[model samples]
Target: MTLTLTSLGGAGTVTGSRHLLEYEGRRILIDCGLFQGYKALRQRNWAPFPIDPKSIDAIVLTHA
Candidate 1:
């Protein structure tokens, strides 16, 4: 089994926290929160996601 983790957002700053878990050719999104505060952070909200949304198999939001 192969598993890899990718940080879609929320790294250095605090706001949108999203991560992609790829396992066995399946992609799962954890914490689908919105990016808030600061233009840089909020700008991510408008920009296209690093990965394809349709490719994501499931979304598991950790919190509201």
Candidate 2:
């Protein structure tokens, strides 16, 4: 079994928070908030995701 963690957002700033976890044969996502604040951060929202959305098996939001 193998485990991998990737941060889709919430790296060098606040607002949008997303974390992708892949283990075994499953891919789980935690947090799916939108970016808000500086233009640069917000612009990130428009960019394509680092990973494929279809590759994700499930999504679990820790907060609203």
TM-score of every prediction relative to native: 0.88, 0.87
Tens digits of per-residue lDDT for model 2, 1-64? 8898988889877788999998998999888878999888889889888788898899998877
Scored by lDDT, model 1 comes in at 0.87
Candidate 1: stretches off by over 4 Å: none
Candidates' RMSD to native: 1.1, 1.1
Colliding pairs, model 1: none
**Which pairs of residues collide in model 2?**
none
Q: Which candidate is the best by TM-score?
A: 1
